[model samples]
Target: MAGVYFYDNQWFEECPKLIGPTDHSFWLGSSVFDGARTFQGLAPDLGLHVARLFKSARSMGLAPKETETEVERLCVEGIRKLPKTTELYIRPMFFARGGFVVPEPESTEFCLSVYDAPLPEFDGIKIRFSAWRRPAQDMALTNAKAGALYPNSSRALREALELGFDNAVVKDANGNIAELATANLWMVKDNVASTPALTGTFLAGVTRYRVACLLRENGIAVEETTLTESDLCNADEI
Candidate 1:
């Protein structure tokens, strides 16, 4: 994909090889990243996404070298390098290069990649209930956007794809609906929108929060409560 990457105090037209096989992030998965999208010359919630990236870094015990303001500036700068009309996925990442089982906080390094990735059309997706469950907050780095957490989500997604579905609705350890494998789960019933309450098992995305706010502002009822598979099956929309 066509992109601009910022790494090691320089910008590259190509994605530079910044990590080795022995790097802590490569071997032990001590990495955190956040994604924001820029489309139609607008980037909504860019600051929230950037702030979450740093919060994730701190939760993963990595000390990021760039301030949140600096990271946001870099994202904007990277976005400017691409065509104004290009729909892009902007990602800022922090990874560790050293330490054994636990990553060395001082070994954290940061990079930003802005690439052409058009938003998918809303054709609606078919979803199946996955056998997998999200880890509890005490069981994993549930508070952070840590790289290690994605394997379970990928497994759920793969199983759904294999079963001829586009995505999977994953549940928490308590067997309540958590979210979709790729995004937050929402359902509409009698014009009311409801989603799973944030219980620390899944990441409550920036877009999800914004959507809830917008719905409420427009006089739509949005509820965050425990959801079950039966709720999904009975909903007017999902």
Candidate 2:
């Protein structure tokens, strides 16, 4: 389950072997990463994940050295290097290296790593409403999937677990559903499917996007709109 990883153009035989956590990302928490999956020898929406990584890196002011095609090829190459029939999590990360402890595009590091793991196959995830609200829009990394932003989510999920729930449901400052701790949510009611609109607070996941497409193609009415706490509590199913 452990192997060398690629960073820029070099292979790190031993991780954390790179020089200088001198990067402000180590101190200022200014890094962004994206996740995608390859299953059954097919990487559905792989391109979208690569595109998203670029967008996230751009938002964090880190320059991405890999083009979409390059990223996709690396993903395939990394997976092929693994044992046959293995499932895995594919993470690509980008970080800023210099500049006043504030994240800027210069001196960026593009790291791509793969870890063996099974894809999530939860029949359903239970949830408790979180008292903690997502960071405000004024926050620099609210919706960027940056490492710094995950602590807030982690704490909320921990509290939910302590309270005997399977997952936590985070709300924005406006008290609308943002997302679950680990995955986006969809609620089905009266033959309609609904998910929270991207209100600039949560990640609209790749799997969620594909599911929406399948539902639309099947003539299901899918609505992207604001959902209040009451909407979830009243739902027949989620």
Candidate 3:
């Protein structure tokens, strides 16, 4: 887990400053985080991830001090300090400082935690249909990758784990399958790949986009359509 953090150009490899108890992010959940990955000395899509981090913060009304270039530079520098053979998760986060209901955007704090973590193999995953569902866009800022939105997924995951499953397939307010507890869901039939359309219920991941493109280029049709629990389970493959 050897990596580093930066606070105003200063690097801290250990014992960095932590969020306070009353911080808006800690108390009111005014925070957003985005992740990128490093493997074999290459940081793929770091720019897009950083850009999305800032976008997520802005969507939640928080101001990020660092630019995408700056964040990417810091990530590259941090990855250098870690073991080259080990995979790493590069997470850049932003949080608000003070407010009652709405956060003070100017009080946003930033941290980039690049830590060594192994990349899981893409063998397969076990999923169960979870009882917990996602909120409607009117009920929450579901479009952004906000911290407060994650606890619901965590609960769904806990329930699935208790049932001896690896992950849970979450539903939306309308009883449509939203996604798995951790990622977007895809099903296959007759060599065609289909996934649930973006409905402001989950983050649109970068890998999903690239994979869809690659599939299309290779002549495997990919469709973004509404999906239900029944549709997924009844599919030829998932």
Best by TM-score: 1
**lDDT (Cα atoms) of all candidates against the true structure:** 0.94, 0.80, 0.85
By summed lDDT, which 10 consecutive residues of candidate 1 come out lowest?
119-128
Off by over 4 Å in 3: none
- TM value for model 3: 0.94
Error of 2 at 50 (Å): 0.7
lDDT of 1 by residue, 1-238 (tens): 8899999999999989999999999999999999999878788999999999999999999999899999999999999999999999999999999999989999999999999999789898899999899999999999999889999999999999999999999999999999999999889999999999999998889999999999999999999999999999999999
lDDT of 2 by residue, 55-110 (tens): 87877877876787887887778777776566767887888778776666767777
Ranking the candidates on TM-score from highest down gives 1, 3, 2
Write down the lDDT that model 2 would get: 0.80
Return the TM-score for candidate 2, rounded to 2 decimals.
Answer: 0.91
All candidates' TM-scores? Answer: 0.99, 0.91, 0.94
**Model 3 lDDT per residue over 156-223, tens place:** 99999998999999999989988889988889977789998888877788777877888999999999
Arranged by lDDT with the best first, the candidates are 1, 3, 2
Query: Which scores greater on lDDT, model 1 or model 3?
Result: 1
